[model samples]
Target chain A: MKIRTCKYFAKQSVKSIWRNKVMSLASIGSVMAALLVIGIFLILVLNVDYLAAKLESQVEIKVHLVDGLSDTIIGEIRKEIKGLSGVKDCVFVSKDKALKDFSESLGENSYLLEGLEGDNPLSDSFVVTLEDPRLAPQVTLAIKAMSNIENVVYGKEELEKLLDVTYFLRVGSLVIVAILLLISVFIISNTIKLTVYARRREIGIMKYIGATDWFVRGPFFLEGVLLGLIGSIISIGLLATGYYYIARYVEQQMFGLLVISLMPFQEVLKSLTVSLLAFGVVIGSLGSMISIRKFLKV
Target chain B: MIELVNVSKTFSDGHKALKNINIKIDNGEFVFLVGPSGAGKSTLIKLLLKEIDPDQGNIIINGKDVTKLKRREIPYLRRNIGVVFQDFRLLQEKTVYENVAFAMEVVEASPKEIRRQVPIILSLVGLSKKSNLYPSQLSGGEQQRVSLARAIVNGPSILIADEPTGNLDPDTAWEVMKSLNEINHRGTTVLMATHAKDIVDAMRKRVIAIENGTIARDDKKGGYGI
Candidate 1:
């Protein structure tokens, strides 16, 4: 294709869009709407997965020592827990240190623990962080089987529920995105079919006058791509604005909880914009190709 | 040159549009295809254009078996043949000049060449003055002339006209016929399918009359025979 011919086809595509303004707008609107929903779900799933991962990494199984255990036996227990499979690290918190940390956490109520410091009731334990939080049950069982350990605590029920929610979110988002993509393609293609149907006589005339199938298809294909691009851009714009305001509201409501922070707009925007643009182009072109295939048989 | 040897077309609905049809038209010859309604003339034109494939036998144009041509190769074959339709299928949105230029553009002709050839073709069809007018702004005869200019703009070796003047008044029909005669005289083989008896009888061209999906008569300087 020569540069001149490309320009001609581009001009023709723009003219066609202008000529069929109603259908063009409808296509763009539907595509944008679908993309917006997909974008929202994508952001939601990503943020939920991120927060789940943060909470999972914070999970640590505490192995409590039996009362009156010797210093050497305590050291042996710490070494055993550290060597356990899935254990990323084992930090030994002595009874005195646990008592002091708990007192500090109480802030103004530190005096309540002042008299108990001499007879620290808190147990000296190994705070064992696992490589994967999902292995909490297995790791907890291993620690419990060790000698000189009284009990293990890792918030088992809460961790299981968190993992389940993340799993569901990942699968659910994928299904929703897939269905939305299909709907976008269906809507875009039908809109293009209307355009092709309207100009079927023109296509027949072109066929009779020796226009190649590509020649007949070029303008329509270009038109479809343009529609997709416009739709995606609009959707991205809407998504960005919507995400910014929602993130701001969430931040305001949960100011101290940085662990559940929404993804930074700049980072999400960069990747989201690129993927949406590519999706738009693919859907648009595919729709145009399918709609015009039957007409080009001439 | 075109040759149809034992070509046949039967619709899936069990209607035989053409059967055992044999035709050969040499270079630069003008031929008229005369027939009544449902007499298979349109099917024959379609076969020649390769719009629909033949159920049996081969259609050879310029030494290439058109029936065996690949999907991509059909366009090249069509480029060698220009077609004019009964309704004068002009793009109502385009001006006469753009309509003619579009034919050349489809085949990827250069801008310089299109600018040079479109005007000359429009002049040949005697529509130079109305080159900027849309099809609706022109008379029926003028629209047909614009369609003719578009058809021949690519300098096709064969011009296939299917009822070029079907909707025109007798006087306008003659004007359209005169333009076709001029094109034929300039060495383009012309194959016209028509129901106009007076024009066929007066012109006295070689006539291939079809009836019941078969060639009933093939005559040199033949009149329209009902």
Candidate 2:
């Protein structure tokens, strides 16, 4: 294709789109609405995943030691736990320090532990954090077989349910996004079908005049792309504006109220713009290509 | 030159449009295809343009078998042939000059080439003065001339006009026919399908009359036969 020919195609596309302004606008609006919904859904899913990950990182296992364990045996137990694959960090809490912290937590009830100072009932413990909290059960079972290790405790059911929710969200959002994409393509193609129908006679004339299939199809393809690009840019602008306001509210009003952190506007903005632009172009071009196929048989 | 050796076509509904058509049109010859409606005149034109394939034969244009040409090669085949219709199918949105230039553009002619050739073709068809006028703004005859200019702007070796003057009055039809004659004189082979009895009798060109899906008569210098 010559540069002049491309210019001609672009000119023809713009002219046709302008002529069918109502139809073009309808397609653009469809694209915009579809993208907006997808974008919002995407933001929600990503934020949920982020919060789930944050909560996952905070879960830890408390390993309590057996009574009368020698100091060297407790040291050896800490070393063995540290060598586990998913262990992030290990901190040993001596019984004396544990008793002191327990008393502090009990506040005015510290007097209840005064008579038991000589024989502290609290077991010396190890606070174990993991790289992936989902591995808590396996790591807990492994630590239970260690010498002087009495028991391993973690919120088992809570972690399992959290992982299940995360898995469902990722897969479910993907299915929903795929369906939304199909709907967007359908709307766009139908709109382009009308444009093609209106100019069907012109297409027939062009075909008879020795216009190649590409020459006949070039303008329609460009028309679809233009519509997609315009719709994407508008939707991105609307989404960004909405997200910015929401992010501001999260920071100013909901910071202390919600434990889950909202992803910053700038973090989501880049990927959202890029993905939607690609999506719009794909939807628009695919729609036109499918709509114009039967007419080109001439 | 164009040749059709035993070309036959049957529509999907079992209507035989053209049966064993055999035509040999030499380069630079002006031939008329004459018949009533459904007489296979349009079918013959479509076959020559490679619009539809023959159910059983070969169509050769410029020594190449068009039936065997690949799907992608059809455009180049059509580029060698220009076509016009009864409706004077000029792009209504374009002016006379742009309409002619559009044909050249379709062939991907260079911008400089389009600029150089469009004016010459417009002048040849006597549409030079109306170059800036839209199709709706022109008289019926003027519009037909614009279509004629468009047909030849790409310098196709063969010009096929299917009822080019069907919608025009006698005088206006004759005006378009004069332009076609002039184009034929300039060394381009012209094949026109028509039903105008007086124009056929007056032109006295090589006439091939078709009826019932076959050629009924072929004459070197024929008139419209009763």
DockQ per model, Cα: 0.70, 0.67
Clashes of each: 0, 0
TM-score of chain B of each: 0.98, 0.98
TM-score of 2: 0.85
Q: lDDT values of the candidates?
A: 0.87, 0.87
Looking at candidate 1 chain A, the ten consecutive residues that score lowest on lDDT are A289-298
Regions of model 2 farther than 4 Å from truth: A52-59, A64-125, A129-151, A154-159, A253-259, A294-296
Provide the lDDT at A182 for model 2.
80
Residue A129, model 1, lDDT: 90
Docking class for model 1 is medium
lDDT tens digits by residue: candidate 1, A1-298: 8897799789978887888888888878877887887787778767766666677778889888888888888888888878888899999898999999888877789998889977888898888898888899899988888777889999777656877876887788778777877777777677777778887887887777777778888988998899999999999999998888988898898766444688878877886798889888987888787777744555
lDDT of 2 by residue, A133-200 (tens): 88888999999988777888986766567778767877887887788778777777777787788888
